[model samples]
Target chain A: MVSKRMRVAANVKRGPYATLTLQGEVIPSHPGQFYMLRGEWGISPLLGRPISILGEDLARSEIRFLVKAVGEGSRLLHALKPGETVQATGPLGNHFPLSGWDPQSPVVLVGGGVGVPPMAYLARRLSENGAGVIFCQGARTKEDLLLLDEIQETGVTPHIATDDGSAGEKGLVTGLLERELEYQPGAVFACGPEAMLRAVARLCRGKVPCYVSLEAAMGCGYGVCLSCVTRVKEAGKVVNQRVCKEGPVFEAEALPWL
Target chain B: MAVNLAVKVGTLLLKNPVMLASGCCGYALEMGEFFDLSLLGGYCLKGLCAGGSEGNPPPRLCETPGGLINSIGLQNIGIEEFLREKAPKLRRVNSVMVANFYGHSVEEYAAAAEKLQAEPCIAALEMNISCPNVKTGGIAFGTDPKLVHEVTAACRKATRKPLWVKLTPNVTDITETARAAEAGGADALSCINTYPAMAIDVEKRAFKINTRSGGLSGPAIKPLAVRAVHLVSKAVKIPVVGIGGISTWADAVEFMLAGAAAVQVGTALFSNPNAPLEILKGMEEYCIRHGFKDVADLVGAARDFERPDCNLPSAVIVTGEKVRK
Candidate 1:
């Protein structure tokens, strides 16, 4: 992967959320793949933070990222503005496998908090590929939900859940998931906090094929660092798989969530 | 005038002083997509053991101020797999290849080295002595001078290739281990591997890394590495290869000025895959600006500033028969 210094086309912030659109030569990316982003801030933070691809405009050659200002790095990213340059190395890691599915079957995409971006992108891709799509998102409150309009623009109505009952459902995103599974989706794709992913895995286990994107503190965002590893069962034995290399997307059954 | 960046460590000569440190660059092939691997002075593959390792559990890495901590446990494909799969491809690269090997015992280190002796692509053997000796009550082989000598001597006998022993900075006195490796007939020495360190998660009241403690590397360790290289280079006659938190050409120059014949780029590779090449370019620019004909002239340049005698006058005046007393 190449590290490029791209100019920020725009940095739009709303509430606790921000979206950065980078203007540079398009680095071909697929849904669920991520880039390691670092602001011009010096070495205090050290490593680049991994951000998932929100969407790509191939014609415009613009790549966007949805970031939440939860820490120093994200806060630095939040403060970024137009014309500022940022270092990004990507499109690293394995992506969500979109092929081999029956186009007639519905595919469910679930996300929580900042994890909603990639799912939104996946929703659009799945819909374009002729698969029926459903998007489920969860957040702490109404203002915390990310990319709702963008997700809906993909032509899929987003089922949202908020902790404070300020949004669609007054419960966890899994509550909406339970109701959606009644339709018997052909597959499920999810990304979010560990608790929500575990819940999604439990709900979809053995019933429908499920893929979940995981987040870990990453160093290289490549195979070499071995920093972003997750435990998974392979051939009846548990082994460590690199989240950046083997997956940020993995078959839910393959993971040892318990 | 062209700047000469070539540096020699024993019989092995490098096009430049910048190399990819062990454990940071995987087999050299993974990084080829980012930059040309041949641009580096050398490439030290990840630490290899007798058998393939799955490494530690999840959360193998975490970041600290100006640095990062990694507990990968030296995950690597077994020696046989490396030879069967990776060595042939690595041989085609123009850079010098140094295999960094570690083991839980002296015999295991020797056996692994013996297996690699026939591989023509491997220009040298870098013995990573940080692993704990299973037969020695779990004390790390690098912490004791005797164990360092034993491991070095055992591997020295197993391979005809130049042997470069990598010493850990977790020791009480780094010079002792440097001396021990030289006495063991080592051709060269790599000083200051990662410092043993740990971090905790306050929210969970637990360790951030799965293995609890790991090696700390990055800009934070550069000063400590320079000190180690300064002391160790003075204690031994063999060329010293400096490693530990070298991110830029200035950092590499500091190591050379402190007495390192060459330097290795480690954690910085994660931040920028082009670090080694960037450092090499900066080194060339630095040599040209300073009017130095050769980069080797920077090695051990600080040694002249050492004050060995406290009683010596700072300055002596001589004015024909009126010299200051």
Candidate 2:
């Protein structure tokens, strides 16, 4: 069952989809927990799709989603009128634990394309905990860049990357962070393309502890179905882990990224 | 309501049959806290190797209309550490635990199986033979029946537990590889692993998976799984496991009717955790609704020997564009 008190915050677009913001009382979501907003149905009617929990203004009772319109479900979300009602399910999935994170550590934040959305929230959370955050994100082009205003508002310096020289560095997001590593960050938090994350995982191999958020197209966003498994390094075995229930977030170097 | 869903895979029974396929669930234990492991059919841990796999670079996964493509190159933590940390808690799992093993060579498979066999908690082992032998010529041992035979034999000798050889749909004859596994004394068979496929992010001008190629699984791959399961079931003596894009109980029933002894939900589980529970309930209801006392009656129920011999007629003819019947 879902709460009916949800309110629309914003309906905007970037690429194939429109980003939707919802204002609802905090159902209590961790960094990676997601909310399913759509017509009154499960997956059918292809209703509004699930989006990564970008950030939560727990005090204000609002949450944000960086959605890409890859299909009919997402496309329909663009038509959601502000102030209109929606049926949303969760605050679901696992969240990154800030429990033992050392606040004084120089946290290197790495994200790619829309993956940058969650990292922004992570930076805000880490900053609140007293950690210094350095953010990095990449897109195929400058137009693909998302939420620059909200990010800039956080006051954490951001390093940008695009496939072309449309904005920031010309290469990939990995390049921007590699050069910045000279300054020596103590920890790294990343989410984005696995290839890029794998590269970052290798770079963080011996340098710092890396925590990465993997993206798996999820269905239940719970633990039962084994659909969203990502491989992780557990002692000697590269174990397949579920991104939905286990983590959208994990130790970067700890995951078995090829 | 949270449904209680669990099933057994051969002798190694599970709480439910909704397991984490090889590439879907990373490590066996990553999601332990999110759900009650006791409720799952059983989950196969990530693939493994003797050495650390850096895997291929960049675009690792790409999304298709109904599924996704991934070429993570069987990136593993090397078998040694997995035993030290994962084995202990895994053995204590409320449900069955299966370790999915992969290797770049026959010896690697042998070593991984032998080592994993020693773990008491591991209920069974799944062999993904179609994976590219990264250390060798970068090809799958399953593409040829001979390699599949050799690989299965080596792995069989290395373990005493129930072993399931996962077959690839890339081969001309999936049954040929399945027979090879049977000849090699494999306890069972899981067909098919994702088919060889690729997707391009048109905007980025890049392949969907970082490897420029990857295995495809999801609803789109469901039809292929049904075909493979039918062929292998008819050819082999051991139980046949069906997998593809199983997202619904109705889909599971279809696989069972096509001769899958049990079905493994891959891409469907990614979409919904409660899917397996729903499927289990559906199977039971189907048994009751069909007036069958046990669920086994559903296996291969759709087989029609009258269809111009044993070969299944094309559900939809592409050439003439008509059903054969």
Candidate 3:
């Protein structure tokens, strides 16, 4: 089938990147999946890059993304004006299984830099599910804090951190998470740089249930190119798992730390 | 009436010859939504090894004029996990799935094959003789015909499924290696794997891809791969599947005419997830248009007294000395 081609409803500059909210109707109950977007659409490059779903309003029929301009594709995506049409194939990949959480458990949402996008979607769902969600967001500077108000609407108490001490508490998001461990909730959900994930994995080691969304330059946003594989050690054996297939979100213990 | 683009190699058959090549197609089951993967003839998953391994560090890819160089280092989910997690999905696909296996030692190839041969989804197994030989101590299995025969024979003995030995073109007289593999009891052949290649960045004064070297593929290697298929087809009775730089249906047709039973799609998928389907359709239409009932009849029919027109150099070319030594 031809992939769903949509238009950019709005574009907002956040920190060092830009977030384009595409006009596509994905229900809030979607459990969150990614969209494969093309910057310069058509036959130029056959593969469409995968972008995470940040938040969507079912009534409004709009999906949001928090993206940083890091490469040629992102640069072109960021340069587009609002209402410009770009091709998007989504809500692709598997959705997070939120069955493990309970009402009494402390659900921690840890996000570092741009890895923070999907956490917004997860946090919204956890709040709706009565998981007592604690949203921890981290970025390099003050300008990187995104969707603070949107997060608050979900009844999540937002904790912030910056690399240069420009926001809530200086240091890493894991540092802020260390302080919030006092909540002693049920589980943790995080998305961010690989190094920060390793740090969070170490901090939550055997302490609580943790899940992290992984990022890789995907050729086919679905799971064709085994390029997005991440290693996980299970039962004393290591296995390479596709970040897009088995998960864009995997249990912290289940992750094969690269 | 619909044209039949599926390719049949011995008892094994493909819905279409445009298959997703290993390292290009992760695990067959999880890739369906992106491209309706069921449409392809078959899928060759990322090379699985006996022991779990972490591939080379990133910046694993760099683009060329009409192709790419990748040093993915055979990243796989290992045999056990694949069986438990990816097998069910693979079995569900209408197309074929050929598990691509590589090992540092002959024993590992046998063991990895043993693990996959049990799964009904696996229609065949393709052995990458190009993988570094950690045993006999540290040489690539593909570069030597002796090791090629040994690995292929060991794998063939371990499984009843069709055995395909994927020969690398980084050798002198590829036909000699094809003969060795046939002697080793391979059911068929896929010639050739991407030739060993590299790239350099003029500004940084350094290599573009990680590992400082990688496998070059896409349109650039099509001519060479076609030649390899044509030569190997004449030299051996076992079927040959052509792979390299095939981006369109015309390329697939060219390989078939040159004596390839089927074709594999790798770097091309990096650009279009649905390209395999398009190529498959195009092939079927081409056959019908030419008054042919099945394209299999076209294999190797293009042979003439004069050589085929190919853009690749008549001889293999190398950039510099090996540093990994």
Best by lDDT: 1
Tell me how many residue pairs clash in candidate 3.
Answer: 11
Candidate 1 C-alpha lDDT tens digits along B1-325 = 7999999989999998999998888888988889888888998998887777777776778888999888887778879899999998888799889999877778988998999898999999998886321223123788889988888899889999999988888777888888898998899998877887899989999998888888889999899999889888878899999998899899999999989999999899887887888899999999999998999999988633437766665554231112335
Model 1, docking class: medium
lDDT of 3 at B294: 70
Q: TM-scores, in order shown?
A: 0.94, 0.67, 0.75
- How should the candidates be ordered by DockQ, best one leading? 1, 3, 2
Candidates 1 and 3 compared by TM-score, better number? 1
What is every candidate's C-alpha DockQ against the true complex, given to 2 decimals? 0.79, 0.14, 0.26
Show the lowest summed lDDT stretch of 10 residues, model 1 chain B.
B315-324
**What does candidate 1's lDDT look like per residue over A167-189, in tens digits?**
89899999999998898888899
Per model, state how many residue pairs clash.
Answer: 0, 44, 11
Ranking the candidates on lDDT from highest down gives 1, 3, 2
- What are the lDDT scores of the predictions, listed in order? 0.86, 0.71, 0.75
> How far is B322's C-alpha from truth in model 2 (Å)?
14
Candidate 2's docking class is: incorrect
| lDDT of each residue in A34-97, candidate 2, tens digit only | 7666643343432235577778777888877777765666656666778876666667666666
